[model samples]
Target: MEPLNNDMSSIPDRDALPYRDCVGIAVFNRDGNVFIGRRKGSDDPERSADFDAPWQMPQGGIDKGEDPLRAALRELYEETNITAVSLLAEAPEWIYYDLPEDMLGKALKGKYRGQRQRWFAFAFTGDDSEIDVEAPGGGKFHAEFEAWRWERLSRTPGLIVPFKREAYEKVVEAFIDIPQRFTHV
Candidate 1:
């Protein structure tokens, strides 16, 4: 065997992997509690991380030429069937997270390493009857949540998968003042 050369071409470029651009929504009700959903089913084995918490806020990919704010609203309506909302706040910056090693080349159709998310906070003005996770708007995608509820924004980090906890924490911190500004019915 000949001596191995330090050719950079032989090494895979981790930066070459693209991160899917996506958006997340944290819809808050009258009491300032943010919406959370319990994912409908068990892990796909390939895409899911080993975490007990299934609850998370509404999130999805940003379509071609679609604005991040628009994508946030669209994903919110498509996932929760609620539309009566007013913008509360938007995160100061985009948050990025990577998939676990086992899922790196399998999740998201192996198209990207993970997601780069733009998170938005909205005030839910509609009544509870407006929410129907089973049949979302336009019906483009299947129901992602089996059960849903409103939770304290601060507690969200613990309820999400470990890999996504940091992003959730930042979101909560960025919007921490939201409740004080909109406490009225």
Candidate 2:
């Protein structure tokens, strides 16, 4: 398998984009609010991470032979330091987004031109304190914001990449009622 770049340079390009498979997750809390993290200043270009990276959702790629649900749970732990050891993740459906015409990777320069992703929704059964942004492994966007909150289902606070907004809306719509909090994991 190829190494996952922090900037995703390994994926194919627009037009000729090769097949790149990945996954994303939208995690909701008991109040039906979504978890969105604000990134650090050093990591964002033009400091957009403060706005765009601000509390979107947790998502990552599926490893070879690894299931997407498992990948989602892994990403939850890796990125937000939120563990699913206590909560349950139901079977999630796959959703996808194609990179814009100008954004496809070089390898996929001529292909349908972008990434195909599967998205999932999980209600966090853990406490906010369970999330340790300082966790030891996994890639994290350096953009950081001291403020974090539970966003309502009907609300959208931005920070979500333009191309991914619709997917976030869809995932939140599907899994908003699972549970608010738990500690079994």
Candidate 3:
């Protein structure tokens, strides 16, 4: 991983870089609210522990030959213990977001300039008790979120880090038809 540099030597030209292939999961509850987590880790550019807007939905890199839907479900399960979900919708197009210059090659292990993500919206079918941010404690990933909540989709962009705001905004618009797809139970 490229270390976060104070020097500008490592920064790559924006248009000359590639975007990482990733998937973003937007898990919606029965009430039509979307799930977001308070990111953990200070000094982390993506999470920006010091920033007031530190919340984001579950997302992760798509492994080689993996199906996007499966990857979305896998990321959702790994980050939050909620597997009972019914696919609601998928974005009509992929969304891209660029990393701030400081994170151009430093974040995502310096692999890509930013993320080109496929977003999915799913309706939660399990009871709230089934969701757990903390699970398999001794595993590779402990907990990416310190807390979690379901919020109105319209407010998602405001809760996300500035760099990811455009992606979140697109996600919200892409899935704006969600509420009608799932009736509150």
Candidate 4:
């Protein structure tokens, strides 16, 4: 993975840029493990690679006027192909993260400085057979992940890109009790 570009001098106006509206989903299975996927490397050669910490929970942009929860469910199904789930919890407030300085103008199509995400946690009630990361949502949505797996929720922060790690940490804190809640169910 490429090192996080720390030079902020080049992107002096980044703070003025708007954050992309988005939703993030954390789907936990019967075992209390959370679902994560290995993000496919960017097709753009100029973008930094994510090989170092490529795993992340399913997330995506929220269309204008879309309800956050609805967007969360849509993104989850679109990215993971698992629709059998029950709402577990929602973060009390939106979590925000900034793109690294180097990514300010290069990521998110150069329109946003970062993402402001509303996160939802759901209990996965379906069998693992329902997962089809290779062609999620029956291929209606573009594939963002190359592979997928179940992982401990506590380990997610360490598995995501550095720029998004803090947001993941807040997510873990918000839903930390989720696993135990489903452990005996």
> Which numbered prediction scores highest in lDDT against the true structure?
4
Off by over 4 Å in 2: 1-13, 41-54, 84-93, 106-113, 136-147, 157-159, 176-185
What tens-digit string does per-residue lDDT give for candidate 1 at 37-106?
8887765532255677788999999999999999999899899998999997889999988876666666
**Model 3 over residues 1-185: C-alpha lDDT tens digits?**
98876986556777877888999999988888888888877856766544579899999989999999999988888888778999988999999998887777788888788999999999899998877786612344568887899998889999998888898999989999896665655
**Across residues 128-156, which tens digit of lDDT does each residue of candidate 2 receive?**
88766554133353323344567664565
Off by over 4 Å in 1: 1-13, 43-49, 138-140
TM-scores of the candidates are 0.87, 0.65, 0.88, 0.89
- Model 4 scores worst on lDDT over the 10 consecutive residues at 42-51
RMSD of each: 4.1, 8.9, 4.6, 5.4
Name the lDDT value of residue 2 in candidate 2.
Answer: 96
- Residue-level lDDT of model 4, residues 29-122, one tens digit each, is 9989999998875763222464478788999999999999999989988888989999989999999999877677778888898999999999
Which number leads on TM-score? 4
Pairwise lDDT winner, candidates 3 and 4: 4
The CA-based lDDT of model 3 is what?
Answer: 0.85
> What residue pairs are clashing in model 4?
none
Q: How many clashes (backbone N, Cα, C below 3 Å) per candidate?
A: 0, 29, 0, 0
lDDT, candidates in the order shown: 0.85, 0.57, 0.85, 0.88
